[model samples]
Target: MKKPLNAPVLIVGGGIAGLALGIALRRAGRDVELVELNSAWNVYGVGIILQANALRALRQIGLADACIAAGFPYAVSLHHEENGQPQAARHKPSLLDEGLPASCGILRPALHNLLRDAALAAGVQVRLGITVADIRDESDAAQVSFTDGSQGRYSVVVGADGIRSHVRTLRFPEAMPPRFTGQGCWRFTLPRSAEVSSAVMYHGRQARLAGLVPVSPDQMYLLLLSEEPGNPRMPDAELPDLLRDRLQHFGGQIPAAMAHMPGPEGIVYRPLETQLVAAPWHRGRVVLAGDAAHATTPHMAQGASMALEDAVVLADSLDDADSLESALQSYSLRRFDRCRRVVEASVQIGQWQMRPEPGADPLALVREVAVELMRPA
Candidate 1:
């Protein structure tokens, strides 16, 4: 009789996707270990807009209650016109009658810490201070060699290491390189007085997008997005002046937010990019998940949620397939369609927003395409 394969399945990232996967796979009675690249051991962002589909997927993985406790739920999401006027276009509760609420806003670090605590409580081993040295494709199992000269061979390996993933680069080199979406996103968190209650987004000239995400009753995440400028180096003292100049035309809450900004020390500039993989997401005992598989633009706020969904599908497929490769194949078949749809949709939204001038009026666009968007494809 052959010894049953019992090594822990390895997850290469400890972000939302990998942590959720660790928790879910643990709930499913599978052993897993999450290896994170960052030595700091904390999520970096200030906040994110959580989607309903993501909430439901978390429920499927037994994380619903925990997630709810960690974020603030809102029944509506609003979009505004370029002149700082609120538009009639809104995502209301009805749109999510079959899904989660319209959205939840969360402090990324708080949420990550909560999920990490849950994963640890559920008995997922997390190994820090390690890097992948090499990967060997044996007939029976894929072996992952670490820099410390430690090797782990398992029945399955999940590549959730994020965009620029080592496993993806090693195993599927021909896959699409990450493409920059030609936008620069600057985000910051400010401690706000408890007077603000609503989340808001502004569309301005050249289609710049600025938003305030209230992650808690006490703090808000402010984001200003513009076209990525070449040789984009600005001094710390110059940031505030630059922001004020760029946002002066937006008026309303936008200019006020800029006026009240916490300054350069609080801001982080991120250039957006996406990766497309046009292959089987797995080979033998290895499979990709999260940004390792598909990293999308943040326009729709489905990036984190899509990764959460990946975990549930992967666990379901693994439990159902007879062989490891077959399990990976089943997982790809189950998740590829939905994940790809989200990635493609996110990119489309980014493309539409990153125009050289002010975007078409949402009212006009809605009148023109809302019916088509609502129609069955």
Candidate 2:
């Protein structure tokens, strides 16, 4: 008889992917234990944009409505010239069953709190300030040694940890390291303007790109993308001033938003890096999920969406398959191609922004990918 997937599962990270997977597995009648390295579990970033595909995945696990209620929902995206003259607008089609919006912009903290609460409510055992020190995949189970000196045996081990995944290093030592995409992203939260109703993107002549996304009724976040020749460590004290200097060339509501920019503490900046682990996301009973398996740039805004889909699909596969190996195989087979498209497409868009060619159209590629992603994950 094939081994049953009834034993407890271990998740090594408690970020968006880890939390979502915990909820899905618990709902599927599996005992889940999640470990987060951070003790306080503080969420970083100003906000996040949840495209329709992401909402669909969240809907599968029963969190879509709450996310929509807590976030600013809209379906329109406006493109503008450097001087703020409107160039074009496109409406995204809804992917959810009910009459939900096509996309949502939400505060990172708010979304994190919702997932954390749902995972706990679903009876997931969560351990903070702890992580896996070592893992061994045996015939019957995966032996895990926690950083806290405790040990456990789980039916399967999932590495949902981010790009710098310890589990990945321990398991797949041959995988390529994360590659820098030669660009950095800057984000800051500001009070929303009444005129800002939809997602707006500014094609700047002086700067590469900038965007404004509404996170709530009275709050919005600014995202600026620029080419950083060599990845430089920007100091926090100079972040606010540096961000303002970058935006000075653009005209529009940006000046007004800049007026409300707070101290360096309120700004968030990070160099964009991407990684996609090779197919067969699992070896033995140990598997990889979310950013650990595929980390994409924010150009497509599908990083979190892909992670959420991974959770739902993985749980469904485990419940439907007869053996652990086949279940994990099905999960990777179903996800690899779609995720590869998103990752590669996002990187291409970032490259276009860095070096513009005569015929390159990032917006067109975005639309094509969006339509493809609307399909079932």
Q: In terms of lDDT, which candidate is strongest?
A: 2
lDDT of 1 by residue, 250-295 (tens): 7556666675676677767677888867657996667899889989
Off by over 4 Å in 1: 1-5, 92-99, 192-196, 229-241, 356-377
Q: Which regions of candidate 2 deviate over 4 angstroms?
A: 1-6, 96-98
lDDT of 2 by residue, 1-377 (tens): 13456569999899899999999999888999999999998798589989998998899899999998998999888999878998899887676465568899999999999999999999999999999999987877888999999999999999998999999999999999999999899998888989888899899864378889999998999999988888999999999988888888887778888888889889999899999999999988889999999999999889989999999999999988888878999999999999999999999999888888899989889989998988889
TM-scores for all predictions: 0.88, 0.98
- Cα RMSD (angstroms) for every candidate in the order listed: 3.8, 1.4
User: What lDDT does each candidate get?
Assistant: 0.72, 0.90
Q: Model 2 lDDT vs. the true structure?
A: 0.90
